[model samples]
Target: MPKHSRHSAKKRRDPRRKTMDQITAENDSMTLKRSLTATQLLLMGVGTTVGAGVYVMTGTAAAEYAGPAVLLSFLIAAASCLFTAFCYGELASTFPVAGSSYSYAYIAMGERTAWNISWLMLLEYGISCTAVAAGLSGYLNSLLGIFHIHLPQWLTHTSLQPVPGSEGTALTAGWRLDLIGFLSVILVTALLARGVEESARFNSLIVALKIGVLFLFLIIGVGYITPANWVPFIPPAQANFHFGVAGIFRAASIIFFAYGGFEAVSTASSEARNPTRDIPIGIIGSLLICTVIYVAVAAVLLGIVPYAKLDVADPLAVATQIMGKPWLALLVNGGATIGLASVLLGLMYGQSRILLTTGRDGLIPSVFSEIHPRYRTPARGTFIMGGIIALMTATLPIDIISDLVSLGTALAFAMVCFTVIWQRNYAPETKRPFRVPLGGIRIRGFWIGVTPLLGIIFCLVMILPLLFNMVHALLGGNPVPVLLLVGYFLIGVLTYRFYGFHNSLMAPSRPHEQGTSSHPE
Candidate 1:
């Protein structure tokens, strides 16, 4: 082949292999304001981390899978998250960009990989935001019940629900919509449109309030521990993912959704006042804090009530009711309602930012990249993504999609870990303000660091059970989850081929194009 032809082919193959300098230049040019401090970032992580899973997943995981061993499940999930958190810290410091893992992937791997990671992140944050909103609606309804102000069932429930044991293959329809969930998304969207600083402030306040309520529950509920309830702590296996050692890992996968908040913090790297110092602090600090709180809450919750009876939407409220503390139950419900809203804020914020970055790259419409001149936020993109999530929350059943969220999160985390290893080997001279602890050994031509390797392994461990369950469901006549995943990937591929491939800023023919679109309306 001719040398010029070879050069053109190389450019076509890897057009978006951004160097560290390019990434830094892009960060310097970002319109997003850098008003967030380390403290607010940490609180935002906590606010997003300590929501639906702690308030809801714990009970169902305990009742159906881990039983009293659910506390151990929390530990396992935290451990898996810890290694990825370290990798995120390193990558965030190395490339403090708004796209988070997507940015890291573009710099390390290429644009195609980055686009897929961004797509998976969309699946992660989009569904997660909707799920959190749906959870908030349930808690909100419970809180209103305390005041004897009941909403009509049609207003409180979703219009579509997955059939019990259908694994998402069967759905039941009704004249219903979660108005509270829909409105909550709109409210959070408005706050995010106002600006990142205002949204972080609201999240910090909610985090503080929810932590206080949880600590109160711990203080009062500890004295009521019925030690007998913990007998046979690891329940015997009844079926796949049902009460055994397998169940413990299964429960870990289910609750992994709660640990996703730390990832959201990395998305704010471009907005952090001190990305090098503060991003790591926010990522690692929030994970450690939320883990301890999760374990403590799980212990107290199981102690106060039998795990068998804790599968309801409002598990903490159930425990409080069992303790005959209607007031505490009200408080817990109120805290959950408020806390899940913070999750919505952080997730929606992260999702919109990801869209902004992708749009700037020309993988999607440039309109999403438009920043509001006054608010300095992705207001237009925020409304578009929020509307989709709100519509989904109001209409669709989320139960079957919950595991899919965990799967997407694990994949994105694994890519982040791999990016650290890739950058370490390919761009060793790049200055890193934060490094994943534990030096690595090189095998053959590749250097594999212990932290990132373990991160990948742990993510795979978290993913295996979920995959097994998906296969199990498929074989048992429930193919919705697997089909949905495949369909989503196909959509991503078609999008890249039809739109992203032609319009990409990094295309060989458009090497010098700067993405300076007009401001969003």
Candidate 2:
């Protein structure tokens, strides 16, 4: 501990004295267990990325913008993610910590930047996890339907859709709760609370089943591909936004959320057996796996049904229905349910880790940092996150939750990648276990990291339109996301003002720092 004056002795032993150097030291005494392998980390990345977006959004994107050309949208999103992945790979390898982008920002920028990103991470992980869980509930309903089993209307669908659909599952009574979504959050929270290893094992098994189901659909659906669906692949231009070549980019931006699953994997750096090698492998490998599957699925889905017909809640299930395969459709629905559930597990786990980091850094209440003695996890914070997610699932629709996630992700990913460039200049001598390729080569009398530079550009391309649309939505009275963002921002700012600013480990006038009082009296 740093030396402190006698008058300042009442403060709890200040963590402000701890430095990045201290955390980076070998075999440090942090709470998280280091048991995750490359395979487990990779599976975690894959599990989160291949959820409802591919199962649901592919068709939506096709119906709205790209038509049969949404396959290229997946490829575009994947390329942007690859560059962002490259940035993540280098940082996670170098920092090797639990907070993911928040940790990287702290090392490269300062405390305030880390604080904002960590707060946004709540949207990326916790809120989105809830949305995905809600989606899982819908698919679970679809799966149960295969057995002629159906829940009451209010039990499954929300009242967000004013005119309820024919399934009689959607309710006209205002503000109906998604009972299954609420239940899934609690169940997944229990799994997370048990232990990370146990949760990871379940994730691995379930992810395999999900992927196998996707491949089965691909193999079977290939024969049903009508070549006529390929004509007029890029839909004609529409008035409001991008169409033609621009439509593909717009679709890429929407589906870009699918590739963000790897960010959750990066947060597990503190738990990996060998973070240097494993982090990069986990991030890149899983992205490749998901990208191929997403592209193939998009092609097959468009081939089976017209783009206009693809705009349902469960696109894959709809495609299977068109193919006259009810049983296979049920299997696809089950796969989506399992896939979305695994995503919830990973997101919840990652969110708690980020919360714990902020707590340890004195950005939030330190109690959130405490790890469970027996479970070796952030037990308190994980459960707290669960309750919040559960509330969100019951109140909000899946689409609204998804929009928040995309905005948060683009902001976080862009800043994280930008941090790589900043770090190169700010701490040139800092030991890097892994450096992003194409960055080391000097250009115009400056050492620039090319990958991160392009990453920032790519992320911004996706972020700007979303930002404009969000502002437009707020102007049009869709206030949920704006209200949520402002509410969280105010809470974070107030926390910083009242608590985190003074309590921060990096604070200049810390308990330990020796300084004469200005009054001197």
Q: Which candidate is the best by TM-score?
A: 1
Instruction: Report the C-alpha lDDT of model 2 over 1-521, residue by residue, as the tens digit.
Output: 11243234324222333335645641244667889999999999999889877888898888887788888888888888888898899888888888898888866666777787887787677667877887888889888887899998877766464333322223244657788898899888889888999999999999999999998999999999998987788878784444587778778888888788888899899899999999999998999998988988888888889898887889888888889998898789888988899888888888888888888777787777878899988788778878878877876666554666777888888888888886775456677777787746555434567898888888888887677766777776666567767887898788778888888756777645312211121
lDDT of candidate model 2 versus the reference: 0.79
Clashing pairs in 2: 16-505, 439-449
Query: What is the C-alpha lDDT profile of model 1 across 183-248, one tens digit per residue?
Result: 999999999999999888888899999999999999999988898989789999988889999999
Q: What is the lDDT, from 0 to 100, of the residue 381 in candidate 1?
A: 84
Best by lDDT: 1
The 10-residue segment of model 1 with minimum total lDDT is 512-521
Taking all chains together, the TM-score of candidate 1 against the true structure is 0.95
Clashes of 2: 2
**Residue-pair clashes per candidate:** 0, 2
Candidate 2: RMSD over Cα atoms? 6.5
The superposed Cα distance between candidate 2 and the true structure at residue 9, in angstroms, equals: 34
How far does residue 341 in candidate 2 sit from its true spot (Å)?
Answer: 1.0
